[model samples]
Each structure stands twice: as structure tokens, then as C-alpha cells.
Target: MLGIGIVGLGYWGPNLVRNFSAAAEAEVRCVADRDAARLQKIHSLYPAVDLLSEATEVFQRSDIDAVVLATPINTHFPLAKMALEAGKHVLVEKPLATSRAEVLELMEIADRKGLQLMVDHTFLYTGAVQKIKSLVDSGELGELQYFDSTRINLGLFNPNWSVIWDLAVHDLSIFDYISSGKKPVAVSATGISHTQMGIEDIAYISLFFNDSTIAHITSSWISPVKIRKTMIGGSKKMVIYDDVEPTEKIKIYDSGFSVSSPEDMHRWLVDYRFGDIAIPKIAQTEALLGVAQDFVSAIVRGTRPISDRESGLNVVTILEAAQQSVKQRGQTVSLV
Candidate 1:
């Protein structure tokens, strides 16, 4: 059985503990948090698991085969590096690190240590996203034209990270995973710091790919209602994935219009196609559960996780570029 230690019993840590506890081949042996109150809560709720206020306790434990880090974005690199160096497989929460350099360092360290390094990109593990990836890979979506996503919420903002890193990273990771390794060439972004915090609360980012694929991510913590929606339009079909939906989270629209201008030799004609919108019946499963299962499976079998360190690095690079662009007041930042 895989004994896992979870760090940071903050917002996402409890979910990780719950999921890891539920994994068949894994056990949440230990959980660490700096907050004494949080540690007491965990101890009270999870009586079977050992709880500690110091993260070092879990890290130093010999029984912990793997460590799940749900700490802040800035601390991710250090904690993950320590875990990896301590001969423990690591599962870090999104963005991997604050910058690309740290990401490369962690990847290199994990490679040298020959330990499993997985990023917790929970959205990519969802059934809706997996089904959409199937459509894209099967050529059913045709050549991808544009991917637009909006992830916004009210009042759950983190002072440590910007809106782009806090919310936009979700769409960015989703875009990266669904694109099947297509790298964005450049990015332009704009953001506003509303709360006098150094971090941004609202932001819009545009990612340009070599192919005609362009992805736009808009995130805000000032919105009245939470919006988690993504639309992917292609030459053949269009798709909509709504995380807020309770029943059908993904809907594929077989509707597209084509236009040919006089400049083109094809002649000046407009083609319109309309078809039924099919909501693919996707199985209901918690994303965190799937992520936990994958993380443990990777540790036990020495298999690469879907959201490995490289994938995490890719998402972080885009975020870093986007932030750079934002700092320059929407100047286009080249990824190359």
C-alpha cells in the first residue's frame, strides 16, 4: 500500500486528504499544516491519520512513500524539491513553481532522483475534459480554430497569487492538456489589482499557437456569480464545457458556418451548417479522486502521470509569459 503524506491543510489540502484516503491502493498516513487550528480540525475529522503542525515531521517520516503538496504557489518548488530529495514521490498542486527556472530545476531534480513527479491539474482529470480530448484526437473537431474559456468567481481570492495564477491556470492547464502538446508561440495579457494587493484580481490573457489555434482566458475574482465555462470551436464542430452544470457538463454543437470571399479563388459564397447539439453522457466522478488514484498508481507502477512535471512546467511557462506581458501593459511576450 502507498502511504501518502499531505502538506498544507488550507483550501485544497482537505480535498486531497479525502481523495487520498479513498484511493484503494493508497492511505493518507499523515497530514501536515502550520496552522494549529487546522491541524486540530484534521485530527478531529481524520482520527485514523496522524496530524502534525510541522511539515518536516511528515517529510522525515520513513513510512511516507509519497508526498502530496497543496501549499501556496510560491512554496511549491521548495516543498516539492525537499520531498523529492528525501526520496519521496511528489504530487504538487498547479503552476508547479513561481517561475520557469524553478520548474526546470524541479524537473531536473526529479529526473536525477528517478522519482515520480506529478502535478495536480485536477481539471484535466475530469470526465468532461477527457471526452473532449477524445473528440479532438479523433479528428472529429477538425482543425482547431479557437479555444476560449472564462473562469471567474467572487470573494475567494488568494493574496499570494494573481488572478491569472489562481484562476486562469485552470483554463491554461486544460488548454495545454487538450491541445495534446501544442505549444503557444506568444501571449498578451492585461490585469488590474483592485484590492490594493500586489496580485491581480481580474485578468485577460490571449495565447497564440503556431496553428490557427488561439486561446483566450478571462478570469476575475470580482464577478457576482462563479463562471467556469470553456468553448472550443473548430472547422467541423464546436464544443462547450461548463463546470457549473450539474447534469451535462459538456455539450458538442454540430453547428458551423463557413465563408468564402471574392479574394479567394473559391468564389464569394457563404456556407451555413446546423446540426443537433449532443451532450455526451459523461460518467460522474470527482476530479480530485481521479487525480489521487492516478498519483498513487504512478508511484506503485512507475508509470508517467497524465499531469506530470513536464506538463506542469508547460502550464507555468505560459503563466509566467502571460504575467510578463501583463507587467508590460499588454505587450506581446514571445514563448520562443
Candidate 2:
């Protein structure tokens, strides 16, 4: 059995513990958090697992083959580096690190130590995303032209990271996984800081690809109603993925448009096509469980998981560009 150690029992940490415990081929050996209250709470729920306030103690353990870091985005690099140097496989939460340089350093250490390094982009493991990938890969949604998403909630504004870093990463990661065409070459963004913290609480980001494909993401912490919706339009069919829906999360529409210019005149003719909507069945399994299983499997089998370090870097690359663009008041920033 693979021994797993988890650090940080904050928002998503407990869910990581629960999923890792439930995953096959893995044992939740230990969990660490600085807060005494969080430790006591976890102990009350999972009495069999050991607890520690110091993260290094968990890394020093003999049984822990891998360490999962659910700490703040800023602390990801140092914790992961320590775990890697300690000869432990590391699973880090989204964005990997604050910058591309940090991610590169972690990737280098993991490679040198022959350890499995993965980012916990949990949505990639979801049934909805997997199905969307299949549809795009199979040409069910032929020649994807645009991808648009909106992820917003009323509260939980991050103190350290911007709204783009906290929320836009999800849509970016999802787009990175599902799209097989030319990667994004530039980004343009505009954001607002609502508080004195100077951290962006709301943002609108747009990505330009080498191909005709384009993507737009709107992330905010000030919306009155929570929404998680993505739209992917293609030449043949379009997809609407509403993560808020308990069931029927994916809806495929056989809809598209066409335009052509006459030989003699300069005006163009436009036509639109509308067809039936299909809602394919999606697996109801917990996405976090899949993330746990894949992380463990990658370590044991020496394979690449869906959300590998490279994928994380790709998403971060876009984010880095978006950050620069936002600083320039939505000026387009070239990726290359």
C-alpha cells in the first residue's frame, strides 16, 4: 500500500484527506496542520491516522511515500521542495507555484530525485471534464472555435492571490486539458481590487490562440449568485457544461453558423444551423478520489497523470501572461 501524508487542513485539505483515505492502493498515514483546532477536528473524525502540527515531521516519517500539499498558493513551492528533497513524491494544489520559475525549480528537483510531481487540478479527474475531452478528441465537437467560462461566488476572496489566480486557473486548466489545437499565444485582461489589500477581487481575461480558437474567462468574488458554467463552440456542435447542476451537467447542441461572400458583390451571406441537444450520461464518482488514485498510481508505476507538472506549467504560462496584461490595463501580452 502507498503511504500518503497530507499537509494543511484548510478549505480543500479535508477533502483531500477523505479522498486519499478512500482511494485504493493508498493509506492516509498522516495529516498536518498548524492550527490546534483543525488538528483536533481531524483527529475526532479520523482517529486512526496520526496528526502533527509541524509539516517537516510528516516528511520525516518512514511510512509516508508521498506528501500532498494543500497549503496556500505562496507556500506551495517551499513545502513541495522540502518534500521532494526528503525523497517523497509530492502532489500540490492548483497553480503549482506563484510563478513559472518556482514551478521549473520544483520540476527539476522532482526529475533529479526520480519522484512523481503532480498538481492537484482536481477538475481534470471529473466525469464532466473527461467526457468533454472525449467529445473534443473524437470530433463530436469538431474544430472548436471558442471557449468561454464564468466562475463566480459571493465570498471567500483570497487575501494573497488575485481572483484570477484563485478562480481563473480552473477554467484555464480545464481548457488546457480539453483543447488539442494550437495553444494560446497571447492574453489580455482587466481586473479590479475592491479592498486595500491590492489583490484583485474580480477579473476579465481573454486568450488568443495561434489558431482561430479563442477563450474568455470572468472570475469574481463579488457576484450575488454562484455560477460555474463553460461553453465550447465548434464547427459541428457546441457544448454547455453547467457544473452547478446536480445532474445533466453536460449538454451538447448540434448547432453552428456559416458565412460566405457572393462572387460579384462584397456583401456576405450568413446562415445558422440549429439541431437537437444531447445530454450524455456522466459518471457520478467523486473527482477527488480519481485524483488520489492517479497520484498514487503515477508514483508506483512511473507514469504521467493527466494533471502533471507540464500541464500545470502550461496553465501557469497563460496566467503569467494574463497577470502582465492586467497590469497594463488589459493590453494584449504576447505569450512568446
lDDT of 1 at 284: 84
Q: How many clashes in each structure?
A: 0, 0
Quote the RMSD, in angstroms, for model 1.
Answer: 1.5
Best by lDDT: 2
Candidate 1, pairs of clashing residues: none
Deviation (Å) of 102 in candidate 1:
0.6
lDDT of each: 0.90, 0.92
lDDT: worst 10-residue window of model 2: 178-187
Alpha-carbon runs more than 4 Å astray in model 1: 261-267
Instruction: Give the poorly placed runs of model 2, Cα more than 4 Å off.
Output: none
Tens digits of per-residue lDDT for model 1, 1-336: 988999999988999988998898998999999898988888888899988877778889999999999988889998988888999999999878989999899888888998888899999889999999999999999888999999988978788889899888889888888888789999999998987777889999999877778999999999999999999998999999999999889999998988876787867788989999999999788999999999988888877788878788899999999999999999999998
Q: Candidate 2's error at 116, in angstroms?
A: 0.4
RMSD of each: 1.5, 1.2
Q: Tens digits of per-residue lDDT for model 2 on 197-218?
A: 9988999999998788889999
Error of 2 at 58 (Å): 1.4
Shift in Å, residue 309, candidate 1: 1.3
